[model samples]
Target chain A: MAETTWRPASARGAGGATATTRAWRVWSSAAIVTAVVLAVLVVPPVVNLDEQAVHLADKLLPPSWEHPFGTDDVGRDLLVRCVYGLRVSLLVGIVAAVVATVVGTAVGALAAACGGWVDRIVMRLVDVFASVPHLLLGIFIVAMFRPGVWPVVISVGLTHWLSTARIVRAEVLSLRSRPYVDAAISGGASRWRVTVRHLLPGVLPQAGLAAVLMVPHAIWHESALSFLGLGLPTHQASLGTLVQGARSSLLAGDWWPTLFPGLFIIVPTLAIAGLAGAWRERINPRRRSELML
Target chain B: MLELRSVTAGYDRRDPVVRDVHLTVAPGEAVGLLGPSGCGKSTLARVAALLHRPDRGQVVIDGEVARGWRHRAPRAQRTAFGVVFQQPRLSADPRLTLTQLIAEPLRATGRAAEVPGRVADLARTVGLGDDLLARRPHEVSDGQLQRACLARALVLDPRWLICDEMTAMLDASTTAALVAAVEGYRARTGAGLLAVGHDKVLLERWCDRTVHWDELSGDAAADRTT
Candidate 1:
């Protein structure tokens, strides 16, 4: 190595000041995400998923030590049913978010990288998709197709990808103008190399953050479809279906079914969204407010 | 040799930032480009580096006419010169470490195995210790980041090195140190240098000759009717 007048950058370490806050955020985010993932993975196995476990002998029972969340009109244990419902709702939300991220990242990355007619077409397509209400589209799609898990997943996933696509597009658009990108190109880095090395790292954070935010939206979408009678089948339990099923019971003052299951949907959505926001902050603290939903 | 022959370049605008520009830097020569802010000296540097495609005219490198806006030179051909942009923060990928940034050109050219050794070598050359290689752009001062940029540029040992106002943000001593690093690299490889800045005395001190960019942004005779 040639000797020159090199110097230490700054006396103050970069991560020194924010270390504690970052550690706290990371630990909490990890713990929350782990709990959610564990719940999503573990709840169904422990709980009785069979909503048809009709116990007319225990019909409309309120919360008690024996029946924790109580029983619904079907006489099935509300606790078990709510757990199963959340499991299904969370599953749909996760799969749908994954699907959306994959599709969105592909569209966004391709559009931004290509940046000609492809960009115009993809962006216009996003604009067109963004103009319509996602729920209405999901409902219409569910109405067209047989109401099933995949149909709901597809409907919600496809509709919700517009945001991720937009996020990836915006990220790529900015990253493309970055001088490092230009430097890479000038240094003869191939298109794939540039995309994989430079562009991919830049886009992943925005895309992943958007996808995480989309989970709750997806969960809500599934619930809406089920409420509208175009979501999960009767044999299965989703939080939306459980809440909708409780509508009649609610009128009759059998509030345990609706109230408890509603919390099931709301809590997970809030938890996941909060964790996602925290994780996003952990990744890119600069654009804490600028992250596109 | 790096040559811009009657080049006109801009960012998707009809009116070019630089118009009908001619610039050349021969091997072992150091030329400074002095101009006012936004006068398109950086644009010309970009053209000279083949990083920006000119709207019109040609960028001829080593007697090869690398023309057309979209068509780019292949890996081996384009690796003849390395360019450091004005803003070190913008020019270096923040996610990557100084090690990764310095090794980028080598990795691009299928010399991935040599990255670690070359990175250590360049870190010392730029007067930056290997300890700083792991830190990010925001973690380091602009001077240090600019030194990393210089190291990255020199890692490839290209026939030409172009610094586009690279020292504008650095302190005097740091700037001198960076210039010394570049000079040391130049002495070793005998590469040409093109530096753009607003500093006259500095340019005079560092460059064998200096040139000015034509004012093509507004109020030029090239502008026609409404």
Candidate 2:
């Protein structure tokens, strides 16, 4: 029973009142905007083009006024492809992460709150799914359905939900034993009211951390599936598809195709991971205070 | 008035925490249950609060067995009793404001509309100020939290107040203040109270009669003699 003592109500700091805190707040907001813009707006325009000559002629063009990231084998702008690939990769990651979080949280809350046979059945199903490797599961589901964006999204999203469900269930189980829960029952609160108003909020702060951590994992899984040609189709130009397309070129003399797209895969994943770490740090500021005291 | 008729309750079959216990609290009377640690005082208090169902026996409130009045009582029966837990910190939801916590019993007792005014009055009676109502449990001192718990218990205007080591965590002065507050409330409401504590002096001072549970067996005759 790892009990987290509730923070004092008066400790909730007022929003944007202090100068130093406001500065950091502004900086974080700008960082978020920059990350979104790089992934969404800037990248798509650069990557949306079609020409074999454009791909070849732009190939190996170094960062210059003319070709910022140089060119690939078919002269398509490496920078453009990288940007567009980033957009697609980020979109898949975010959408799949959201789907996994919502599905996992709802089902987990239901199972835990409604214990008995519902809990047993849901947890047993989760255990079965957990035993399978996420990559293999994702690939199998993508292959079963025709390879497409939403299909891959659903497949990967559904496959990763077990972990989230398990985490949330663990949280809910511990919360159920707390005295406030008993108090709520004794106070004659309906089961649903207790679950929704009391248990759910206690579980959410942890669920948020889980969601952040899951995004990178989801992105990587989607990329791997796409790299294996079981993800979004060729026309979609995801980072995974880009990596797959560039694999042969890498074996040949050309490295630009693989290198740029690989960066596309790695950079955003690292950024998301960084954001998750920062969020965890922010939420558990008590850990630092405990050390200080 | 509240009565426990040969109440037998425990977590399991092997060892009954409370073994065929019988007790009674007359109207407007304060009965202190005195026992050492691990003497099942808390278990008995829970049974009296209806938080725990007895293995065998009846919990009678106002001369009617609880099971018999189940249909007729509804929210009224629940509202007729309030429990102050051993640890006030664990008694109320940490997320709820003092106002919400105090008003909870009122809402639970199906008197939601009366909560706002009732809560304000209870807060004042319990010596909590207006500023404290907006504060969460952790924001307040332990004494304040316990007072809030007391305020919560008072909202339903329960005929019986079951205090299970309610002052155990408080310092001497704070405990004395709580006792005084209880005395004031009793004078105002004429409600029966079952005060459970290990502190013999405090129990004796607060209650009209003290019952050392070990001296009384499950026999009604034994209870009458005591």
Candidate 3:
């Protein structure tokens, strides 16, 4: 065997205190800054409704200092409307993601803990849900309810939980075989105690990753539903509705309205995915030492 | 007394690893189980520890037959013995510090208030330094982590102790220190001990009576009891 060397623990950096030089940090920070700006713009008093008022004389103006995203055919400031639209989309996405994560984690943890036939049955149910394409199922569900925020949120949340459920179930199954879990049981811990103390904490990172990644998907799902005129009222400023209303202008040689909203959706999705990747590396015990302190 | 009567157990029921094993350890006595690697000694040790249920026969603890295994065992039966395994790293939770690891049993058994003092006392007994108690398993050497595992095993002060190749992965000096700690605990509490190891000379020195795996076959072996 080749000669081996050992280093003192002190020589290695602290686990999470280390600086990360990954390229994704730049994009993640930019995304966070954009989200914060959009949040500020959504504050009730900060948002000026006059920008959304009809000024037909100034209609179809291209991008400029006065109206950065230009005026729509009805003369509403495209920037203000897009910001409001993004705010609605973000709110719906987050609420839906939370709902999905909670349901998925509970179902997965239950299936794994119960094991035997219960596990097989829950996994089969997951397979059934996963077999159907998310967009089609989401649209089908949304079409049943009145076009509104909660209906869209419920539809997106219900359709997206299958992936999270699968991830958490796999994670919990792996964690079940860990020796520490056996040690906990041998130490006189009840099933519930072991589940709460060991199994749940072990699965949190993977579950959090699932939730973060689900946000972008949920946003797009809501957008698709809205664009199909099956989500949020037509007057509500959502990225989907804005994009849907801008379709005529987009084909009429005016593209700012459609272009800006499209960028708003794509940029944040990429940023969040990037941030989740960084988070996965940070929390992973095996690869944690590889990070610089 | 801790006794395994006609026990037959293995991972697979149809092909049991260790069969019809009979062993007993009286209070204050250390019984070393000596066998070569893959000779089913560890499997026997697990059966003796009540961590694994026997395919037949019974595990009689303090004259009472244990009716359950693992977490299903009665609280008194479950808490009656403390066990230490071969690999400390695999046995301990990575997220916990040495203090939390050692205090796990105390916390689990609802003796929460006694954790700090008991863990500190056991750490000293096992020769684990205060500085080492704050570190996780990955942050410490094999010897340091094994010392913590020993401390964890002895923290509950049970009537019985089971060491299943506990020092096999450790160096000689660590092995000596851990054996001394177990002996010291036994002397104080008069606890019955079942030390499972392949090292014949070490077992002869540490235990009151050492038994070979093959000797545990028939009724004749039970007659050689001390």
Q: Estimate TM-scores for all models.
A: 0.84, 0.81, 0.84
Model 3 over residues A1-293: C-alpha lDDT tens digits?
A: 99987656533433424244454364565667477455635554576565458889988899999999988888888888877887789889889999999899989998998788999998999999999988899989988988899999999999888878888888889888776676676677787777778888888878887787788888888888999888988888888988898899989989997998888787776676556656666676345422210
* Candidate structures ordered by DockQ, highest first: 3, 1, 2
lDDT of 1 at B86: 81
lDDT of 3 by residue, B1-226 (tens): 8888899888899998887888889878899999889978877776776677789989998889989877678877776777888888888888889999999888988999998899989988988889989999999998899888778777777788889898899998989999999989888889999999999999999999999987986654666764
Predicted candidate 2 versus true structure: per-residue lDDT over B1-226, tens digit per residue = 7989888888886788888888989999999999998988888887787777778888988887787321123555765777788788888888899999988766755678998889888887878999989999999999999999888877777788889999999898878877787878889999999999999999998999999978544654566777
Error of 1 at B222 (Å): 12
Candidate 2 has a TM-score of: 0.81
- After TM-score superposition, the amount by which residue B120's alpha carbon in candidate 3 deviates from its true location, in angstroms, is 2.6
Q: For each candidate, give the interface RMSD after superposing the true interface residues on Cα.
A: 1.8, 3.6, 1.5
Write model 1 residue lDDT over B121-205, tens digit each, in one string.
8899888876788999889999999999988888878888888998999899999998998899889889889999999899999
DockQ of each: 0.45, 0.25, 0.48
> By the DockQ metric, which is better: model 1 or model 2?
1
The deviation in Å at residue A237 for candidate 2 is: 2.4
User: Candidate 2, B26: how far from true, in Å?
Assistant: 3.5
Deviation from native of the Cα of residue A243 in model 3, angstroms: 1.6
Say which docking band candidate 1 falls in.
acceptable
Model number 1 iRMSD = 1.8
